[model samples]
Target: MQKNSGKSVLLLFILLIVSTLSAGCTDNSSTSQTIQTSEETSTRTLTDALGRTVEIPESVDYVICSGVGSLRYLTYLEAQDKIIGVERSETTNSASNAKPYSLANPQFSTDYPVFGETRGMDDPEKILSLDPLPEVIIKTYSATGFDPVELQEKTGIPVVIVNTGDLADNKEDLYESLRIIGEVVGKEERAEEVISFFDENIADLKERIADIPEEDKPTCYVGGIGRAGGPQGFQSTEPTYPPFLFTNAINVAYGDMDINVADVSKEKIIEWDPEIIFLDLNTIECGEDRSGLRLLQNDESYRQLQAVQSGNVYGVLPFNQYATNFGSVLADSYFAGKTLYPDKFEDVDLENKTIEIYTFLVCKGDEELGREIYNTMINVYGTPAFAKLDI
Candidate 1:
């Protein structure tokens, strides 16, 4: 009887030991599987706009934009929600906020932190010091003097390069940049929507003006092109101005200089004597009394020009604000077409057109915003000055 009882006790002890070993193995296997899954899901490799291979977070929720137009591109992609910081210029300059992107994303003005010195001038130390450090950094190809690879090495963070090209002539580059940004933020569909919008608008504009004879197109000149906050005088102009190019207007300033934005002599402007003149509203916004309109209103040489004498001088919304407000560019094209050839755009509703553009670009269709933009471009203190003969 004692031996049988001892045998039963030994059998129970062996069963308990087996049970303990099985539980330990199960727990360890679960831990190993969890670790492996985490490792697999944490990161992914992608080719950026510059074609550089980078391993970025699989779920990117935080990023920093570095360069002149990088933030603007991100805004277009509707990924501003992921932006953790901005350049100091974005916070300091109230005028910069006048851009449609800024209007749409007010959080940039109120809540986000400022890290870099300014657009295109990144400070690595400041970037590293950001609390809850960003997951990735996206910079314009020509943004900073520092090497992007070096930056990645120093910070141990993936750096992606995007090219924010001249939107007026480099639509391909813009589309590529948008796609790259979308890929990073997982907004590929949104990027395609933006590209489609651009494509449709440009194609429609081309179709509308395709049959207009070149000789019938009015000779046009744009002045008061702003640079670094100060307005250029009457002679300052863009040779490849998008508004002029897209609307099929004869840009008298085209090929006048080798540079994109150049200042020509007043005599040279008079020599060209374009039939229509577009004044950039930036000078008036600057309040520095350096506007082309101020010169046209004050100077006899400008007043004697045929376009001004004929009341063909028109106001165009500032396009260069915070690196080319693309909405403003398309809007300016419509207004230019209307002013140059009223009969061509007679059926077009300017207010509705502006709202449509703002809606697509900034995702805002607020009537008040559209009205403000319209007023800023066409009216001076409630007086309609677009194409008006008298200054």
Candidate 2:
């Protein structure tokens, strides 16, 4: 029995030594293979939707954005270094109010350098001629107003398309678009993280407001422009587009009107008599700096409306919020929600929202961007009720 025990101990000792040696050899082999693969891994090249087969650095370095919506998504990815240029019109001095605030960090537009404005997308010669060509050009589907394939042939730069425009009906399609941007920017983890955050927060918001009585839901009107000459002050009958429909308020316009937008008379608005009126701030007055309420007050015909009397006129910045584009609409939704339900959303800080939006949608830093966004909001909507509550 003693002899058998000694033999078993020796066998175990030998097996332990063998295992250690095997592990050491495996580690060395893996290290060698990794080094070899790194040397052999060439930069990948692919043909984007634009039909241009462009080569990209194994590490994507620069991205040039052409439209607002695509820029917002790229900023959210935290892939700012990838941005090389942007359309000049995005930086128009007269149209500084155009950038959407809610879903963007200020850095996206203010910090990043602009190449030139995209006056017309069909002129590929202009985009291609810009100094320091970009590795990727992110564009919106409808805004670019050009066939992507043709553009690619002219510029020889790959184009990535992100549908930031809420043209998609539901949230699932929206997330899918995020995933696509993630794949393009090589930030899949960040994309998923952002998508998850949006889902969780939105779900929480729905739950928080779900138990509230329907009777308590605020009656709101949303429209593209403010008409002061109407019998009622400002009409609250805008269609449920990107931002306004996502808010906590009930859309009075959608509920009561069969608006074809072809021939909406001023008298029709007086019939609705909305409690709240939200208008496109940028497009109002044929071009003027005034709130929707002010417009109603200035016009002699609108003295009878409840909205103007109650001071419930809300202004939506058209350059950013009303634009049927990517980040613009998302920002519009965030701002619209907060504006509609200030009491319930008081805790939902815009700063944090701005940062998250910049990270998730704009993919950029959250610096001066917040201030710029706030400024745009103030210009469009007037200072929040809280700002003047002390007075």
Give the best candidate by TM-score: 1
Candidate 2 per-residue lDDT over residues 160-247, each given as its tens digit: 6555534335566556656766666798898887777666655655655656577877776655442222212234335545454455
- Model 1 has an lDDT value of 0.77
Clash pairs, candidate 1, are 311-389
Report model 2's TM-score to 2 decimal places.
0.66
Encode model 1's per-residue lDDT on 10-38: one tens digit a residue. 99999999999999999999999999999
* Model 1 bad stretches (over 4 Å): 1-37, 143-146, 228-230, 257-260, 285-289, 364-390
Per model, how many backbone clashes are there?
A: 1, 24
TM-scores, each model vs. reference: 0.88, 0.66
CA lDDT of each prediction against the hidden true structure: 0.77, 0.55
